[model samples]
Target chain A: MKVVYLDNNATTQVAPEVLEAILPYFHDFYGNPSSMHAFGGQIGAHIRTAREQVASLLGAHPDEIIFTSCGTESDNAAIRSALYADPEKRHIVTSRVEHPAVRALCAQLSGQGYRITELAVDKDGRLDMEQYEQSLTPDTVLASLMWANNETGVIFPVEKAAAIAREKGILFHTDAVQAAGKIPIDMGKNTIDMLSISGHKLHAPKGIAALYVRKGTKFSPVMVGGHQERGRRGGTENTPSIIGLGKACELARQNLSQENTQVKKLRDRLETALLNAIPKSRINGDTEHRLPNTTNISFEFVEGEGILLMLDLYGICASSGSACTSGSLQPSHVLRAMGVPFTMAHGSIRFSLSIYNTDEDVDMVIEKLPPIIERLRSMSPYWTGDK
Target chain B: MWEYTDKVREHFLNPRNVGEVENPDGVAEVGSIACGDALKLTFALDENQRIKDIKFKTFGCASAIASSSALTEMVKGMTLEEAQKVTNQDIAAYLGGLPQEKMHCSVMGKEALEKAIENCLGVTETSADETAGHIICECFGVTDQDIERAIQENRLSTVEEITNYTKAGGGCGSCREAIRGIIDKIQFEMTPQTAAKAKLSNIQKIKMIEETLEREIRPSLKLDGGDIELIDVDGNRVMVATRGTCATCKAADITLKHFVEKRLRDLVSPDLVVEEVTQ
Candidate 1:
C-alpha cells in the first residue's frame, strides 16, 4: 500500500535533490574539512559553499550561520548563549505554545533562579502583544518564541516581537523549524537576533540544523570542546547531513512560491472537505495567518487514537494532540493555553502536508476520513446526532 | 505510540455492546470528559437477577473503549455478586493486557462496573468515598482511599506508577509528597521506614509524648530559662503548657510553633502537630 504521508511537521521525506547533492561526501570526499592536506582542502571549499547555501535561504551571511545537530540543539545553544552573554539579567520571556525545546529549557532555567514570564495566546492561537510588552522588563535577558506553532500552524508576529525586544536592548530568538521552509523568512528584514532551523522539518535528513545569529551579536558557546564553526560550536561536524541540509535549504528557497500556492490550496481543500463531511469538525488555528501546508481539525465526540487507528488501516499518516496519543492525561498544552474546550482538545488531529503530497492524496484522505469519524461516533456512547 | 496488544486492537476495532440498555435495571457513570476519559455503563438483569444485557458508552482512548467493551462481555451471564468481584486486573486480563500507562482505562471499567452493581442492589453506600477521607489529588479528584486501593491492588511502587495506574499525581503534582508518604506508610507496616515514626496506640502515644518532653524538650527549655510540660496528646496534636519564662515570652506563639513544634516533628512522627493549651 502506498502511504499518504501528511505528518510533515513531525518529519519530512528527504528530497531526491538533497540526497544527490550530499552523496559524494560519504565516499570520495570523506576527508575532514579541518585537515591541512589537499584532500581536506577540497572538502573545506564544499563546507563553505554549503554554509553560503544555507545562509542564502535565510538571507543571512555565511558567517552568521552555525550548524548544530538539530532544531532542539540549535534552540538549546541559542537560549543558553543569550543567558551567558548577559549574566546579570536573570529574567526570560516566552510563549505558552512553545515547542518542548524552548519550553523545557526555560523551565529548567527557572529552577536555577531565572524568572520566566510565559505570554499567553488567545483562542485562535494569536499572541497578545499587550501582555508581551508588559513582560519585557529591564531584568529580562532574552525572549524566545517560535515563529509558527508546531501543533497549530498559527504564525506569530515575530518581526514585531523582535523589534519590541530590541527597544529594551534584550536578545530575541525564534524556533523557526515549522516556518522556515513553508513561509517567507528574510533575516535581513527582521530584527530577531537569532533563529533556529531544523533539517528534517524541511526535506533534509535528520541530525543537522542551523542557528542563524545576527552578525556581531554577543557570543557564547553551548558546546565547548574543539574549535569548530569559529569556536561558536564544538565537536566534529556531521559532514553528510550538513551538505544535505544546505541542499534542502536551497530547494526550500526556490520552492517557497509553489508551497504557498499549490500546497496551500490542497490544505484548504482538505480542511473544507473534512469540515463539510464531518459535523462538529473545525480548524484549530487562525486560518489566515498560518503556515501554508498545515491544518489541525478536531472531530468532536470521537477519541483521537480511535480516529488515528482507523485512518492507519488505509495507509494514511497523521498525528493527534490527544492525551492518550502523548501518553499523558491531558491534551496538547498549546490547545489548552488557547482555552480550547476539553471536548475538542482531546480529539484534535494535525495533518501537516509537504511538497511531495499530491491532490490525489488529499482526495484519498477526504474520502476515507469522514467514514472513520462516523464509525467512531457510532460507537461512542456520549455522541448524539444533534451536536 | 503505546504498544497496544493485538487483543486490544481487535476489541477496539470491533467493540461489542456499544449502546445503552433501554430500561436498564442498573446505570452508573464513572469519570468525566474533562479528565479525558469517561464511561456510562447500563445493565439489564434477567428474572434470575443475572446480567442478561450489558452495554457501555465510553469517551476515551482505545484502551478505555476496549476495556469497557471487554467488561460488558465478561459480566453478561454472571450474577451481580460475581460481577461485583471483577477487578481492574480482570478487565485488563480479559483483553490480553493493557500497557502499564493505560492501566487506568481498565480501572475505570471496574469502577463503573462496581457502581452499576451498587445501583442494581440499591446500595447507595459509597463507604470509602461517602465517609469522605481527605482528597489527596484535587487535579483528578482522587481520594486517599482511591490511592490506597490502587497501590494494594496493582502493587504500585513509584509516584509515577501511581499516576499511570490511578492518575493521583498526574496533574499539577502538588499532591506528590502526600502520595509518596502514603506509599511509604503503606509499604511499611509500622512506619519502620522512619525511626521517628511508629504506629502508636493511644496509651503508647501518651507515654511517648511524656518521654519525648522529658528527654528532648525540657532540657533545651531549661537551658533557655524556659520549660515545657506535656498536657495532652490527642490524635497528632501534642497540646502542651509552657512553664516559667516560656509562659511570659513575647514570641510564645513562635516558640510553640517553630521551637517546640519543629523539635517534636523532627524527633517524633513527622505527622505530629503541636499546640499550646490554656493552663
Candidate 2:
C-alpha cells in the first residue's frame, strides 16, 4: 500500500537526516553525557550543541532549554513550576481547549483546592481576549494556554495572552507541542515564561522534548535527581534521541518557510478540493488563524470513524475528534468548547500535513475522501442528499 | 485504533443490504445524530410472514455500521419471533466479538431489530420513541429502562459496563449515582432470593438498612440540604429520621416513601419499607 500519512500533528515521520545523525550516537558514541570518561564527556559537547539547535529554532538562549521525556513532561514541569513558585496564588487561568497534558493537570489541581478558570473559545475556536483578561485575578498563579490546538489546528494568541498575564505579574506557559515546528516561534520577542515542544511532533524521534524556561523566571524542578539538565530535569540523557531532535530542529528551522508556503498550499488545496467535491462540509476552526499545515473538516451526516476507516483502506492516514475515536460518548472537547453542533462534531476529521507531504499526498486524499464521505453519507439516516 | 474483529471490518467495508426496503412493512429508526449514532431499519415480509428483504441505513462509527449490516444479514429469511430473539450479544458474537466500548453498536442493532418487529406487527406504527424509557443519561439520551435492560441482558455488574453497553453514564457522569441505583436494583432482583429463601436475622436486617442509608440514600439527601438517619429496623419497616432541611421540607413524606423506601428496597431487599420518625 502507498501510505499517504497526513496525521502529522499527532506525530511526524522522523526525517532521514535526523535518523542518520542519531545512529552514530547509539553505537559509537553510546556514553552517558554525565560520565567522567572523555568518550562520555565528548557526548556532553554534542548535548550542548543539541540544546543550542533547539534554542535556535525557538529564538531562545541555549541555557534556557531543558530536555525532558516528552511534551507531557515539559507541560507538567512548566505548570508545576509556576504553582510552586507562587504557592500563595491558588488560582490558574487556562483555555478550555488545552491538550490533556495541561487540562488533566489543571483538573487535578482543582480537586486539590486550587481554582481553575477555563476560558472559553468562540465558534471559530478562537479565544475571547476580553474574557481571558477578565479571568486573571490577584490570586492567579499562572496562565497556561496552547499555542495551537492539536485537534482543530486553531492558533491562539499566546504571545498576546502571555503579555496580558505578565502585566498582572502572573507567570505564563504555552503548550507549543503542535505549534513549534509548523510555525515560526520567536521566544525572545514574546513574554511567554515557559514553552513546551515535543520531538515527535516535528521530524525527531519520540521520547524526547524540550521546555523553554525564560532566563529570569522563578523555577522549581519537577524531577529532582543528579545535576542533569542543570538539576531542572533529572535523568540519564536520551543521547541518541536528543541528537536526533537537534538535527530535526535544525531541519525545522531550514524548512520553516517551506512549511508556511508549500505545506500550507497542499493543506489548502486538500481542504478546498474536499469541500468542493463533498456537500454539507465545512472547516472546523478559524481558517485564517490556524496552523499552516493543518485543516480540520467536518462532513455532516456521516461519522468520522467510518470516513477514517475507508480512508485507511486506501492507505491514507488521518485523525478525528469524534467520540467513537476517543472512546467517549461526547465529541471533541475543543469542538464542544467552540459550540460546534453535535451533528458536525461527530464527523470532524483533522488532516495535518508536514514538510514531507507532497502535492500527490494532498491530491490522493482529495481524490479518495470525497467518495468515502459520499459512501458514508449514503448509509446515514440523517443524510437526505438535498439537506 | 479499535481492535475491531476482521468480520466487523469486512461487514463495515462491504456492508450487506445497504438501503431501505421499498414500501416496507416494518420501518424503524434507533439512536440519534446528537448521540453520535443512529440506524434506520426497513424490512418487507414474505407471504408466509418471514422477513423476505431487510435493509439498514446507519450513521455512526465503523462498528455501528458493521453491526447494522451484520444484523440485516442475520435476520433475513427469519420469522419475526426468531428475529426478535436476536440479542446484541448474538450480533457481537457474529462479528467475532466487538471491543467492550463498541458493545453499544450491537445494542443499537438489537434495539432497531425489536422496534422494526414491533412496527411490522402493528404494535406501534410510529416506532415509540426508542428513548421513551425515562431519560437517565441526558447527554446520550439513555434511559433507566435502557440501562436496566443492558444490565440484565449483558450481566453487567458495574456502572462502566452499563455505559459500555448503553452509553448511560458515558457523558457528564452526573447520572452515575442514578445508574448505580439501577444496577443495584437489577442485581438485587437477580440474586435468586425467593419467599422460600432463608429469612434475614434482625441484626442482619438492621445492618443492611444502615448500609443502604449510608451508601445510597444519605449522599443524595445531603446534596439537597437534607439527611437521613436510620432510627430502627424492625421486620421490613426500616425507621428513619430526616435531618437538616428534609425534616421540615414539604416533600418529607414523599421523600420517605419515594426516595428513601425505593433505595432501601432496591439495595437491601425488595420487601423493605421506609418510615420517617417525626420529631
| Candidates' C-alpha lDDT | 0.89, 0.91
Please state the CAPRI-style docking class of candidate 2. medium
Each prediction's TM-score versus the true structure: 0.86, 0.87
Q: Which whole-number lDDT from 0 to 100 does residue A253 have in model 2?
A: 95
Per-residue C-alpha lDDT of model 1 across residues B172-202, encoded as one tens digit per residue: 8899999999876776642344444466688
Error of 2 at A187 (Å): 1.3
**Which residue pairs in candidate 2 collide?**
none
Worst ten-residue run, lDDT, model 2 chain A?
A: A378-387
| DockQ of candidate 1 against the true complex | 0.49
lDDT, candidate 1, A218-308, per-residue tens: 8799899788899999987788899999899999999999899999999999999999999998899898899999999998887898889
Stretches off by above 4 angstroms in model 1 are B125-129, B190-279
